[model samples]
Target chain A: MQINLPSLDGTENITAVCMRPDRYTRLYEALTCDTPVIARGGGLSYCNAGAGRGCRTVVSTCFDRILAFDAEKRLLTVEPGMRLGDLFEFAVRHGLYFPVLPGHPSITVGGCAGFNVHGKTQHNVGHFIDYVERFTLFHPDHGEITCSRTDHESLFRLTIGGFGLTGYITNITLRLIPLKGRSVLFQKRFVANLKEAVEVMKQLSEKVDVLYSWNNLNKTGDAFGEGIVFSEQFIDEETSARDKPFHLFTPDMRSVLRFNFYYRPSAHMECAVYYNMERLTGVEKRCALKATAFPIHGKEIYYLLFGKQGLREYQMLIPHDEWAGALDDLRALMNRMKMPLTLGSMKFFTGAQDLLNYRGDGICLVLDVPANRNSVEYFNKLDEIVIAHKGVVNLSKDSRLTAGTVATMFPEYERFKNELNEFDPKKRFNSALRMRIDV
Target chain B: MSDKKTAVVIGASSGVGRAMARELAYRGYRLVLVARDRAELDILAGDLRIRAKVEAVVSPLDLAAATTSGIQEFVARCAADHPAIERVAITAGQVSDDDQGPTPLPLLESIVKTNYLAVIELVAGFARHMEQHAGGTIAVCSSIAAATPRGRNTVYSSAKAGLETYCRGLQHHYRDTPVRIQAFALGYVDTAMSFGQKLLFPAASAEDTARYMADKMSTDFRVGFYPRFWRPIVMVLAHLPWGVYKRMKF
Candidate 1:
C-alpha cells in the first residue's frame, strides 16, 4: 500500500507508507500498529502535512460516506474522508449547504477541520471549525473518544486546527446552512490598488454572499494590486429558473502547462493578458455555485506551472490597522528582491484567535512565487515583515516556515505543544509539518 | 414502488469486492453484501444505502467455513427477499505467506477450501438458483498465478488453477442455458492480497478493476484476464518449454 505521493505544491515528494482502511476495525489496526502515524485524507495539502519520513500514512479515502442526517436540526454526521464537493452535492439535494469550503472540491472534511480552512465567506461565516458540532477521535493511547463543545471541551478545541497531531479524526458532525438556491448572480469590479481592493471587499461583505479580490502582483509602483474584485449573491428560486443549466465541477488531469512556464519576463505579460481577458468579459453573469466555489477544478494546471521545482505560497493575515503598511513593505521588498509574483489574492477574515487556527479580523493576502534562490531569501525576509506587523502565516499552506517564526506569530504556540504532549505523551501521531516545526 | 435489480457480492468487505459493491450500487442495484467480517460489511452496507440510496443487506457468511447447504440456503433467502436477483459476483480468495515449500497441512487445506472448493459450491448454488428465474450473471475472480505457478505460492496457485478449470467446465455446460458465467483471471490487484509483495508490474487499483468489471457485465465475454494485457503474458508463460519455465524464478 506504500506509494510515492506529492504535495499539491509539488515541492515535496514523499515515499508514503499508506494504508487505505475502509472499516473501523481496519482503521484501528492501522492506528495501533506501533509506528509513527498520521491521518491522510485526499493527500491534497499544499505542504506534506499528512506524510512524513519513517511514518505510516493512514489513508481514509475509502471511509467516505454519510453516516447519519437529522433533517430538522440541519445537521449531518459524515465519515472523515468524504470530499467537500460530494458533501455539497448531497446537501443541495436536501435544500441545505455547508458554506465554509476551500476552493478545491477534492479537499476532505477532515482536511478542513485539521487545518481550520477558510473560504471566500470567511468574514461572514468564519472557519470550518465553527460548523463542526462534534467528532470522534481515535488515539493509540486513549482509545476512541467523543469530543464536543460541552464534553471533552479542551480536546475539541485542540483537535481542530491541530493539523492531525492530536489523533485520527474518525467521523464529524457538522451543522449545515440552509441553502436558498444553487444559482448565484456574480459580478466583477475593477480595483486600482491593494488598499482599494481591501476596502471594496470589506464593503461588499455586508451585502454579498461571497467576496474576494484577485490582484495583479506583476505590476509595480502605483499600479500594484490592480485587478478585479468579484462579488456574488444567491439567486432566489424564481430568478434561478431563467439561469443557465448548472453542472457540478469535476477535476480533470489533462494540463496545458506541460513545461515550466513561469519566469520574470513572461510573468508580467501573462498577468496583463489575464486581467484584460477578465476585464473584457461580462461585468455581470449567472453562474453555478459549485463553479464559483471551486474555480480551480478545471484549471489544476496552475499548480504545475512552476514545473518540478514547484512554487511557494506565502499566505498571511494582517490586522486592519497594519495591512496598508505591510503591503507597502512587501511591495518594496519585491522590487528589491526581483521576486516574480505568479499569483496574488486577498479575502477579508473575521474571527477571534484560537490555538494555532488562522483566524483574526484582518485581510488575508496570498502570494504565489516560483521556488528559486532569490524567492527563498525573499520569503525569509517577508516572514520578518509579517512578524513585525503582528500577522500570522497559514501553517497548512507554507512548508518552509521555521518553528521560531511560528512561535512569534502565534502567541499560543507553547500552549498548543504542551497540550498535545499531555494528551499524547508518546507522540503516536506525527507529520512532516510537525517535524519541520519541531512541535 | 421502485423496481430495481439486485446484486449479490461475496467477500464485499475489502478490495475489489468492496469497490464492485459500490459500482453495482451506483448502477442502481440493491445489494446483498456477503463477507466474513460483520463490522466491515455493516459499514459498506450503510455507505451504499446512504450514498447510492439503494437497499443494502449485509450477510456475514465465512466462505471458508460455509457449507454447501448453507450457501444454497443463503441464496434462497436472497431470492425470496429480493426476487429480482440479476447478478452475483464471487470475489473471495485466500493465500498464506507460509504456503511456500512444505507448508503445514492445515494451511494448505484452508487455502484449498477457501479458494477452490468454496467457490465451486457457490457457483453451483447460484447457477441452480438463477436457472429457476430469468437467468443471471455469475462472475468469479481467479488469479493469474493459476497460469504460471511459482515456487513462492505453491498451494495457492494449484488451488486457483483448479478453480479456473472448474469455472471453464461450468461455462461450457451452461452454454445451452440462459445462465451466464464469467471467470476473471486477475493480475496483481492493488488489494490486501498483493499489498506488500514486490510485483513484476504496477498493480491495478481495486477501483479501476471494479470499473472494468462493471463495464463488462453487460457483455458476452465469458473467460478473460483482467487488465487485458495479462492475457498475452499468461499465454506466453504457459506455452514456454518446461526446461525454460523451470529455470525461471518469479
Candidate 2:
C-alpha cells in the first residue's frame, strides 16, 4: 500500500508499505507475517526514532487520545499521540503545569519521554521520566504491559531514555505540578571573572527556583564573564495580577536571514575592531575573518568573537565541593594554553531526582570557542581536561565528546544499557548519541 | 530534430513539482507530466505546451494506488508509448496536519508508500528499462531540513533523508552503469505548500531551483544542493558542537 507521511517541519513524502497496523497486536501480526514493522507517533523526532529503514509496515499512535485527567490532583492519563503543547495548555488552565518542555511546542508526549528529554530546568526537575507516574506499553511479543517505579521499575527506567525501542508507548500517566501563578520573577546579572561567576552561581543556587545563563561569546578582557543570568520564580496570584505578563512568542523572519544571522558588537571598541577589519580588505584575510565570524550572528556581538571558524563548547557538571577547584583548574588551563577566550557562563542547578541527572549538586561551566575542525588534536586535549576533572558531559547537547570519554563520564552506562536490554533486545531506538555514548 | 531532449516529470499537478515541470518545459525539454489530479495536470501540460512549445503528456493517476502491482505495468506502458523519454524525475508528495484526528495507520502507511517506497519501486522498474535502452537520468527531490531530526514532521524528514541516502548508495552501486542518479537536497521553495509558513530562512522559487537542477543534471555531481551556497553553511551548522548550537535560538 502507498502511504503519505507528513513531517512536523511541513515536508511530505509518499512511500509504499507492505502492510499497516493500528495497534501493537496488529503490528506484531504483521511483523510475524514477514513484514517489517516500525512504530510512529507525531513524527517529531529529529532522527529516525519512529520510522524504520526498508521497513514495510508502519504502526502509528497518531490515533492516541486522552484517557483521563485529574485537575485537582494534577495528573494526566493520555495516549501517546497527545501533543506536549496541548498538555501544557490543559495544565495551565487547571492551575497546574508540565515543568519541562523542549523548544518546539508541537512535539508529542511520547517523543519527549522516549528521548528521556531534559530541559533548562533539568537541574531541578530532572528528565521528563522523573515526572511520569506510570505507562502502558505494547511490545512485539511480550503483549500489553504496565511499567512504573514500583512494578517493572527497571523496564520503566530503561524505557525512559529508550527512545521507543522497548515497545510502543500506548498511554502515559504523567505527574503534573500545581502552578502558584502564570507569572515569573525574572532577573539578570553579570560577572567579572570565571571564578567570580562560579562563586556567584553557587551562592544564587540556594535562593532561586530556576537558573540558567547565556555567555556573551564576544566579550574579552577582565569582563570576559559578561553574560546574561536568567533566574525565574513562580509569583503569587496577587503579584501576577499587579504586573503585565510578557508572553514569549516566535515570529517568522526569513528574508532578513537566509542562511546566517548577522553579528553586531556589544561595545564601542568591539565595533571599532569590526570596522578596522572591514578596512583591511585583502581577499584571503577577509575570507578568513568571515569564516571565523560566521557562527556568531543575530544581534549578539559576544558570540561573533568566537569568529567564523565556528565554536565548540565543553560543558560539564562539577560536584558542589569540587566546583571551586574546577574553576581554578579551568582558569589555569586557559592561562597555560594561552587559549583565546571567547565567552563563558555558569548556571546553578538544584540536583534532579533522576539517576541519570548531570546536575547532581553543583554548577556547570559551558566553555565556548571556535571549533578548529582541521585539528582533531585540540578536541582530545579539551576532552582530557574535562575527564581529569571528573565532569560529565551532556551527550544530548554535545557533538564532540568521544565514545570513550562519554563512557567514562556516564558511568551508569552499563546500568542504562542493562535496562535497555531488558526492554528492547533488538535495539530498535538508536541515534548518533547512542552510537557516540556506546549506549 | 531540435536536439532539445525530453524529460518525464511525475507529480506535476501542483506545488514545487508543478513548478519543476514548467521549468523543464521552459528549458526546451519535451515534457511528460504525471499526477493524481488529471484536470490540474492537463491544465499545466497545456500551459507548458502552449507557452514553451514543448511536447507534453499529462498522465494522471493516483501514484499510491498505482504502486500496488499496477505501477510496473504503468511504467512499461509509458515507455512503450513515449519512446523518446530520456530522463525521469519523481516529485509526487502529500501533506497533512493530522488535525482531523490521529492519522489512521493505514493513511500514514500509504504516505510512506507513495513518497518513499514507491519512488524506489518506480526507479527500479524504470532503471531496468532505461538501462537496457543504453542511458537515462533519475532525479529525486529531497529537503535539507532532513539534516536535523525535528520534533514535528518526523516521518516526512525520515523518508526524504532515507531516500537521499538510498539514492546516494544506489549511485555508488551503479558507478559503472549508464544510468545516472541525482538527489536534490532542497531547502524551502516558494510554493503553495509553503504559502502561510513564515519560514526562518528565505526560500528559493521552485522555478529557479528546478532550472538549476535540470541544468546541472548532466554534471558528474550525483548529489546537488539547491542554491549551491547553502551546502557549506548547512554543513557547518549540522556539525556544530551541540552545546553551543543548542543555546542559540533557531
Calculate each model's fnat, 2 decimals: 0.41, 0.00
lDDT of 2 by residue, A283-312 (tens): 121111111111222333343333333345
- Model 2's lDDT to the true fold? 0.60
Going through the candidates in order, state the TM-score of chain A alone for each one.
Answer: 0.95, 0.69
lDDT of 1 by residue, A229-338 (tens): 99989875433333332222211121224466788877787788788999888789887776676766666667656776777888989998998899889888877877
Task: Provide the DockQ value for model 2.
Answer: 0.02
Model 2: lDDT of residue B194:
57
Worst 10 residues of 2 chain A by lDDT: A285-294
Best by TM-score: 1
Sequence-dependent TM-score of model 1? 0.88
The residue ranges of model 2 lying beyond 4 angstroms of the native Cα positions read A1-65, A81-83, A104-107, A217-221, A237-314, A332-345, A352-359, A367-379, B1-250
lDDT of 1 at B188: 89
